[model samples]
Target: MPDRILVPVDGSPLSKRALEVACDEYGTAEITALHVIDPTEPGYSIFGVEYDPSTAPRHGSEAWYERATELADELFEELDALADEHGVSIRTETVVGRPDREIISYATDEDVDQIIVGSHGRGEESRLLLGSVTEAVAFRAPVRVSLIR
Candidate 1:
């Protein structure tokens, strides 16, 4: 009996799968697609690839933040359109911070009844070793959580 379902998307295949599952499962309920841009992500220091500090967007710059915002907005718009096609009402939100913490906090603060998420995001190895945002939300969320891989 979920009234509100939260789905976190990161422009990944698994996230899209989760979105599909959420829409099917909660056909008449409100669906919210949230994208989190982690400001602490050090895209600069890659062990294997050549690190380019100049290529990395500075978190404090207005241009950097704006670009990130636009990207997230585009992703949400796609999700929103798909949800609309399915006759489901969907809302979009973008937040800045660590993914795990932000997701958990949002679920707790909002009246979200369920969370549908992918078990792993872009960080494959890191997710295997340190767990993922899905795991963090599953353990700490005040509501039910459905993890899609």
Candidate 2:
């Protein structure tokens, strides 16, 4: 029954599966694909030197940041093509920040009817250490959220 559906994408197989679900269920609905670049991610650190907590590289930094942004744009372009094939209107964005917070904020601001997200199992230890972004979004979003395995 939702008219506008937001599906966050990061080129992961799980996220692609969520996109499949969106295409299947909301073939005629408006879909927005969002890819957020988490600046905190230590994408490339020399000598495996643990990323400094005090001075983490800004999310949108020199070379790596541009690479991430370019990748996000490419992913969205692919999604746009898929949407065109399906005759469904699609919108895509590449934001810089924490993934979950940005996604939730965008959904709230856009008034998206629902969010369909994929869960990337991080094992027990990782989940305990960092928790799950999908879980946090599910719990905090103002609108309906469907967590896809």
Candidate 2 lDDT tens digits, 1-149: 99889998877767767777888899878888888877777642111224453465454468667666666777778777776666666778788788899999999999899999887767655644322788788889999988777
Point out the worst 10-residue segment of candidate 1 by lDDT: 42-51
Model 1 CA lDDT for position 120: 63
Q: What count of clashes does model 2 give?
A: 1
1-149: candidate 1 lDDT, tens digit per residue = 79888898887767877888888878888888888887776431111223245874665566667767777777778787877777777788888888888888888788889999877644655546323667788888888888886
Off by over 4 Å in 1: 42-56, 121-131
Which 10 consecutive residues of model 2 have the lowest summed lDDT? 44-53
Highest lDDT scorer = 2
- Write down the lDDT of every candidate, Cα atoms only: 0.75, 0.76
How much does candidate 2 score in TM-score? 0.78
Could you estimate the TM-score for every candidate? 0.81, 0.78
Could you tell me how far off, in angstroms, the CA of residue 143 lies in candidate 1 after the best superposition?
1.1
